[model samples]
Target: MNYELICGLETHVELSTKTKIFCSCSTEFGGEPNTHCCPICIGLPGTLPKLNKAVVEYAVMAGLATNCEISPVSKMDRKNYVYPDLPKAYQISQYDMPLCKSGWVGLSNGRRIRLNRIHIEEDAGKLVHDRGNTFVDYNRGGVPLIEIVTEPDLRSIEEVQEYVEKLQMILRYIGVSDCKMQEGSLRCDVNVSVRPVGQEEFGTRAEIKNMNSLAYMAKAIAYEFDRQVDLIQSGEEVVQETRRFDEGSGCTEGMRGKEDADDYRYFREPDLVAILVSDEMRKSIQKQMPEDPQKRLTRFVSDFDLPEADARLLIEHRRIADYFETAAKGAKNPRAVANCILGQMFARLGTEAEKEQFEVAVTPEQLHELILLLDSGKIRMNLVKSTLEKMLDTGKPAKEFLSEQDLAGMSADDLKAVCEKAVAENEAAAADYLAGKEKALKAILGSVMKATRGRANPQEAEKLLADIIRR
Candidate 1:
């Protein structure tokens, strides 16, 4: 606790372009081993590489959404590295002049995590390890990616989570990438260090690479922080190296020595020309960009009069927010629609994947029709809820389950008649209510609901029954 945690993150988001960054090969996920690759992807001689225009556009949209400055001129650089997954032995990436720079992702705690840069690069392939031999899949090789690097601004585990989640939300909202960690669409490399509370100098950092889960990432950073602090207090130095998070042990194991930027031997790529972003191009991308998540959150709260918490839950995914807007377009009470989504509909969506997809049996239009019935007073909330369950079960309209008599609704006189009948049958309950047994009123209310087949409004029936009992 005496040491302060200092952390920075490097997030790699694979753009959903149809083709690779510098090759025409398919970037589709889950292809057969090496089937999607061409001669250019494997670094064959005399195979010229061309940049994908969509990759540039997608990168620009991401930059604009994150409040980054788009560079007018940028160039690709070959980062020399040798790995089995990287068949090219060198990666085509941006180094000196990245596509986006100086951006900040804001945390809910009001702290802005300063972004160092966001650069486009080609992704490496996958390595499948068997008993002893390792097989390589070049299908993912040359897939276009954008690396978002942030300065050492994160100070706590909570901040680290908020930062990553917000980035994922923004990337998915803008349609550049899905940011699914399970599918390797998004991954992070965290640099963690510690210093004494009163010291300004940072301790040596250990970089934890390819942490896909936010929970594991937080644990790794916490363990690494304590590890560094212990080392410093014991008169030992923390080593700067790359590490992998051991999920079973909840600790980070050192992989290799961390390389500085110079280790990559970055040089201007002769195969590709410089990237130019004119005002016209930037404006075009801006028009294609969707609304910011923060702005949308503000609009949802102010326009729908939703509680901030409810609004947040609604906007956590883009599809859910869109579904809400469609269902609550002109409803009298938008909160009811929010309830049906966060409550009844969410119950059926068992997993986070289902919530993200939001594929429900009931359509938004169908839900709006149901809410309209409640708005018109044709059905009470209790009936609405029950009918919604049926509607969800059968994927049918409210009328499919609602009888004509039920939809007609119980008139005031009809409700009073039901109330009187219930009081006549339950004489003991009526007497107990007058005798100051408040709990007995619920029994009488239950009788009325049963007699009317749950058609009578509880509020009206209870009030009418209470008045009749006093007389």
Candidate 2:
């Protein structure tokens, strides 16, 4: 019997707030191991926790962006668990009273992945395992996080990847989280199961914990699906448990038996009061929501006439999208601007860090000027590329690079002279062209562009070359 895979995700996103969720300690990524921790974050005696207002505001913004229903009244609860990373012995999280619920993120294929809830919580510390030794770092402890839980609506690996990417784009666009997988700012726990093709009930599910990379997540899910199927074929029961993906072996090893909701012994936090989000507060946060990435992508395709692929690339990063719009504004050809930005400009920037630090290198005006020059036939396309490189390297404008490199297109007199030289040099080819060897004209045009050092306009020079050789 054919088996169908069913998967859901629990994505944990670290907020970009200035301080930790319940403490004033720094939430910066890399620091001395335990230095960022304080009495409250480290769970020292008699220290009380306070909620960061910015955390709530950011959570509400995320809810609004994802079409979630913001909970007017929510509260935190204690999840009791013992681990090396969690210092509090009991984690303060939202069990039943989550901040956002019943949301959905739309995919490019027009499928909607329904969200169960987006709850606020604190991040646990990191565990460093060396040779026969283990260490815990509390730097990330008490860092604000929003756990986005999705319903089991995904059936394929492609849908899961697309849903995660779309959700990341929305979160990043709303300025809630950076969603950097490498930095552990964004991580996912995938719950996967396989059932018969026509089965309504799901098979025994395995939860893969803390998958930080999307590529690795796909691999883990694929392997786990096969593992479950193999077990069933062999007549062994598929046990429900927590598993950790082994990157080296490209498989998953069982971690422990999966715990149900009652296993955590959840209860309301006695130290903190319930969070009351008023209607006015929700409206205020909603007012600050930016244009959704998908909406902007649609507008770009319809209004700006950008191809869907180009539009998707632009809207992947909010800053890059904003830069494209600013440069395309009032330009002769917005498509040209989009192409240059996506093709040439992004090629030069190279890395994400360089792209983030890119505002100083090329301005919107400079890009617009480059497009204008190309459109007006003032510079050849080759010169335009070199000009962009020079602009990036020296942080200069396109005009400066064009003028400094003497890259101006050859004048009509200069071009005609070069074409004549090319014809004189390739007399046999010129004669062949006159003799109706039409392909000979292309050879002559190459030589003219070479003689002019690629400054000769190909269209104008071809006209001149054809006219010269035909006469």
Candidate 3:
């Protein structure tokens, strides 16, 4: 029997607020191990926690972006657990009521993942377990985090990956959080179960803890799916517990006993005041949201008349989308801008070495100008591409390189002159074209372009060659 995969994700995004959730400690990543902590964050005796107003606003903003309803009032509760990371014995988290609820995120496949709730919480410190002794780093102990939970509507690992990616993009676009998985600013926990294809009852689910990257999550899900299938096929039953993903082995191992909701012993913290969201505050936060990706996609297609795929690629990166719009200003060919950037510029990014090299080159604006130069025929396309590489290597402008190398587009007169010479140089090509040989047309054009060192536009050369061929 074919088994269907059911998956749900609980993702935590650390808000980009200047300070911690309930303390004045810095929330910045990569600080000295214990220096960013304060009395309230480190759980010093006699310290009381005060909620940060900005955290609530960011959570509301996130809610608005994700189509979640902002609750008028939400309170903090203690999640009691004894772990080395959390300096405070209990993590201050939203338990009974979250700041937002009843939301839905739409997927590209036309599936809607219903959001159960979104809540504010303080992050735990880091525990470095080495040499049989665990050391605590309290730097991240009280950082503000927004936990977003989705209903068990996801049925496949691919769907879960898509949901997390879309959510991350939304978070980044709204400026609520950076959502960088590498820095632990954004993290995910997945709950997965499998049921026979036609069975109504759900199988026992296992919680996969601490998947750092999207790639790892996908692989872990596939591995777990095969493992579960084999177990059930051999008459073994799956268990419900927390499991850890071993990056080395690419498989999950049972870690420890899993705690149910009742194990938390949750209760309201009397020391902290409850957060109340007013209508005005909600509207204010809503207005601050950027043009979401879906809306931007539609506008780009309508305004620029770009293909849906091209428009999606352009809008995928906020910087590239903005650059496309800006470059199209007073320019006729928005499509060219999209193609050049996505085709050429985007291929050069998203790597560590490339990122370091990019810092030493011209900005995106300069590259946009180079495209304009190519479109206007002020510079040849080949020269523009080569000069871009030079600029990337040496931080020089394309225009400067064009002037230095004299790779400007050949003038109409110069191109006509080369076309005349190319036709005269090869009698067989001329004779073949006159005999109605279509392939000879390309050979003649190639000769002219080669003679001009590819500085002449191929279209212009082709037109000139056809005119000369008729003579």
Candidate 4:
């Protein structure tokens, strides 16, 4: 029997706040092992926890961006657990009263992935194992986090990937979290199960923990789906448990039995007061949200006449989108601006780091000027490419580089002279063109372009070459 995969994601996003959630300790990553911690963060005997106002604000911002309803009042609870990474032996998190609820994120195909809740919590410490020795680092113990729990709305691996990417883009665009997977800022717990296609009830689900890579998450989900289906087909029972993906083996290994919510022994925290989001606060945050990426993409396609693929690529990077908008404002043809950005501008960004850094040498105004030049037929496409390279290297405007290098397009007289020289040199090609060999004109145009050092206008030079060949 064929089975359908059902999947849900629990994503933990480390807020970009300057300090830990409950203490004044630094929230910066990769600090000296326990140096960034303190009495409150490491859970000392006499310390009391104080919530960070910024953490709450950022969480609300994220919620608003995702269309989540902000809770007027929410309180924190103690999640009782014992682990080496938990210095406090009990985590302070939201149990029944989370900060936001009932939200949805839209996928590319117009499907909405429903969100169960988004809760604010403190991150646990790290456990470092090296060569049979184990070390605990408390630096990350109290880092502020917002856990976004989604419903089992995703049906396939591709949908899961798209949902994650769109969520990341929204969070990043709102400036709440960087969502850097490599640095552990954004991490996901995937819950997957497989059931017969027509079944109403869900299957025994397995949870995969701490998958930081999206590509690997896709693989792990696929493997888990297959594993569950195989067990059901072969007269074996599928166990509900927690698993870890082994990247080297490309499969998941069982870690431990899954624990239900009651297993955590949650209780209300007495020290901190409940969160209260006033109407003014919510309105302010809602106003602060920029236009959503999807809306911007739609506007780009409609207003600028950009292809959907090109518009999608442009809006993926917020900075690039901003730059494109600024440059496009002054451009005669917005499509040309899109082409230059997607083609010439992207060519200069060689590495992922460079793209992430997004340090373009040319300003939007300068790029607009370059596009205008191209639009006005002042410079050929080939010279525009060379000019862009020089602009990237020197951080100079295109016009300045073109003027300094004398790379301006050749005049009509100069182009005709070069075409004449090409005809005299390539008599066979010229004779073939006169004898109605239309393709031979390409050779003549190439010769003219070469003679003029790529400064000749291609269209004008083609006309000039035809005239010279006919003569």
Candidate number with greatest TM-score? 1
For candidate 1, lDDT tens digit of each residue in 171-213? 9888899898889899999999998889888888888999998
On a 0 to 100 scale, what is the lDDT of residue 400 in model 1? Answer: 90
Residue pairs with backbone overlap in model 2: none
Listed in order, each prediction's TM-score against the native is 0.96, 0.92, 0.88, 0.93
What is candidate 4's TM-score against the reference? 0.93
Q: Model 2 over residues 136-249: C-alpha lDDT tens digits?
A: 999999999999999999999999999888888899888899898989999999999999899999888989999999999999999999999999988998988889999999
Of 1 and 3, the candidate ahead on TM-score is: 1
Estimate, for each residue in 121-221, the C-alpha lDDT of model 4 and write its tens digit: 99999998999987999999999999999999999999999998998888887788889988899999999999999999999888999999999998999
Cα deviation of 392, candidate 3, in Å: 5.6
**lDDT agreement of model 1 with the native:** 0.90
List per-prediction Cα lDDT, in the order shown: 0.90, 0.88, 0.83, 0.88
- Better-scoring candidate (lDDT), 3 or 4: 4
Q: Candidate 4 clashing pairs? A: none
lDDT of 4: 0.88
Superposition TM-score, candidate 2 onto the true structure: 0.92
All candidates: CA RMSD in angstroms? 1.8, 2.6, 3.4, 2.4
